[model samples]
Target chain A: MAGKQLFIVTGATGGFGSAILRQINLLYGEDAVIIACGRNKPKLDDVTKGFAAGVKHISVDFAERQGLKERCQAIFDLAAGETFSAAYLYNNHGLASDVTRLAQDFDDSAEIEDYFFLNLTSFQVLTAVFLKNFSGVPHTCVNISSKCAVVAFPSMSLYCTGKAARLMLYKCLAAENPEVKVLNYSPGLMLTTMTENFHNTVAVDSTKKTFQAFKEGNLYVDTDESAKKMLGIVKEGSFTSGEQIDFHDC
Target chain B: MAGKQLFIVTGATGGFGSAILRQINLLYGEDAVIIACGRNKPKLDDVTKGFAAGVKHISVDFAERQGLKERCQAIFDLAAGETFSAAYLYNNHGLASDVTRLAQDFDDSAEIEDYFFLNLTSFQVLTAVFLKNFSGVPHTCVNISSKCAVVAFPSMSLYCTGKAARLMLYKCLAAENPEVKVLNYSPGLMLTTMTENFHNTVAVDSTKKTFQAFKEGNLYVDTDESAKKMLGIVKEGSFTSGEQIDFHDC
Candidate 1:
């Protein structure tokens, strides 16, 4: 039990993050140490309580740029100086639906800047911190992207831009840093809090119907199914370090 | 002559924007007014002076969020209640060459955010401003993207992410706004200021050699040739709105 692998999952309070954590616990047994990170401590505790004592919860707001590296370093230090066999740095934190609405309403540059900072900057900071501190070979950084990253949907401009930038960032990091296994996971349209608003506000009936189909599993995926597929891909590990692994295929 | 069409060209001092301005002047005669926009007022003046009195220069930093929409609205107002027939919003403005170095040395979140704002948000703002105000049909918005938008490159994360976002933004806008002509131009591997920096700093001697060959017309494209081909494409207007036009075929 002492020598088992360690996994780090960000946004652990979210639907996708919780699903992934559940899958890992189920597959890897109670020996595996799962570091569940989220901004909400109560939510984190609730999520991790069911899991074995091996699960440790860490809470840190990535948007607070002051001493982010130091905070990440402290997290690494608490891990008993053990380098992970594989680290899953899931940068899954995202904005509420109203932010997308704000981005769509204004052509103002300042508002756009704020959106970029919130959605895009946090991903960059977390990635850099993980890469610098985590000395794990064949380390996996699974960036949670969306269908918005590939196909652009109306009224989700802020979400679309941020997700798209993260996709490109992963690609760049893959090309630059060949050692780290970088995967862009497009967990195709789920019924998360993010999608609920998307369902409510989309003007076109066809678009809403399509999102409904996706949510109802008539289209493709949910958090649990997507997480299972993603875990399968991680276990397979046949892909190159910087390859984009779409969960739908698995 | 008084009723001739109006066009707005952002980053009007640089390579692609300047060339596009020159070609438009040649095609539309002295009646066509080109509103040259950039942060560099002196350079804008120098670039537009040789053209007919129809050319007007405006200095505005699109990166600044405060009052950007108003400032852009003023530019449109200068057309004397005449909306643009087409707006070539080419923001060829880039950051310092030490961007990758800074991202690596310092924290990249803020800098990456800035890059996204400059490259992606500026385009969005300009497009929104022009589309909302202008009533003309067949109104064109040509976004100058790079090869990096499609293919990931090392040490150019900012450029790559920003360009990718720009490309997708145009795609989304094209899908949503069928009335507006949105074109994504991937001027593949041009001998631009951005490329020159990559050749100098990076250890990739082969890339530098290839760039040199390109400049010497040994590889594939020179600036003039690329510009001429792009101008022909723009003039033909054969491409569907939101079509991604790569220079490799041109």
Candidate 2:
């Protein structure tokens, strides 16, 4: 009980996110205190029911800008008065941009601001509070980044931009703090609802064709496999701090 | 004057923006229609006062969310019913981040949102409207980028994150629209008020020392010279679309 491990996973009820939770439960079992965060309360509750570890679910809508700080603070407060041997934060929550529109079609300031508020701002706030709260513990921070973070995809202007911004933010965080271990993990294109929506709705022909090929060839990565690989990387801890590690690279 | 050039420069009152304006004025002279945008009306008027070209000043506060689309639309409306041999958008406006704090210190949602509104959101909006309005013309869009876009610096998280996002945004734009010439120009460390603020207020010692060396060794690039090189790059039409051309790379 004194050497308990802590894990906080955002977007924990989603397909890839749930895989991560399962991987943690498999790896750490009763030694872990898993805090799973998702917007849907019933879904979150359902997802954590099978885990062997003590799992706590927090209903958090990252899109809502009001009381965001307080919300983040509440997340950290869950571990109050308890000392962990190690803490892990998997920053896995983000929404895909409106893919039906081209890059130049985004002329509305309010729309762009709203997109970033959920993707980047709330993400940053959560990470900051996590780091502050777990200052004494050896913490590992993972940004569930994407291949689009480094490569440009047509009709994914907002998603690419947000990912790139997030990667840089984590890089800066790593540079500023040498104590914490940071990893920008680009989980390969997995067969998730998000990817399904992207395949169906992307406006550009070239981009659509690429996704079409992936689907036809059945080349999309398995969510559970990719999640397990990421967990393996974390266990090995060979990645350079602040570097982006893609799924295929392993 | 039938094949006259159109040049739109934002942050026109600032040091680098003014230099770009002067370079365009020198290159095109009376054959250019220049739209200079900045928040300070008097300063904008003063900056364009000496230009030999036909210059128009638009007072815009990119930070303000209210009516931002209308403001960007107003910029393009100035070039309505006008045809040009080549139209250039010097997306040269951006503010430095608050360097007095570390990357993990930015926990407030509104503060982060406000910073990006000025640095990235308005920048994207302005570029989108510019490209849409000038669709018929041979358009060249330049995002006045920084080395920070690719490299993370301590105590400069917001600036680096914003630049990285903007760069990826332009990359997507270039991919989506191959007809438009796109360039991400990283104007090297220049002697400007922005640099002065950064050099003075940066919280990290390593970052502060690097700037100190630049200041002590007189290693900062001249704003006018760097601006001219960027213009020359535009004239040469040599860089790969969406690639970042740094100051020393030439």
**Model 1 / residue B17 / CA error / Å:** 2.2
Off by over 4 Å in 2: none
Candidate 2 CAPRI classification by DockQ? high
Retained native contacts per candidate, as fractions?
Answer: 0.52, 0.88
**Worst ten in a row by lDDT for model 2 chain A:** A39-48
lDDT of 1: 0.69
Query: Candidate 2 — which pairs collide?
Result: none
Q: How would you encode candidate 2's per-residue C-alpha lDDT over B7-125 as one tens digit per residue?
A: 99988888899999888889879888998887788877777787789888788778899999899889878878878888899998878899999878999999999999999999899
Tell me the lDDT of model 1 at A227.
86
Q: Using lDDT as the measure, which candidate wins?
A: 2
In candidate 2 the C-alpha lDDT for residue B176 amounts to: 90
lDDT of each: 0.69, 0.90
Residue lDDT tens for model 2, A1-250: 3579999999899879999998898888988998889877788778777788888878888888899989988877888888899999999998989999988899899899999999999999999888888667898999999999999999999999999999999999999989888999999999898999999999999999989999999999998899999988987888899999999988
Across B147-207, the per-residue lDDT of candidate 1 in tens digits comes to 8777766666667788788877777777666766677887666555656767677533443
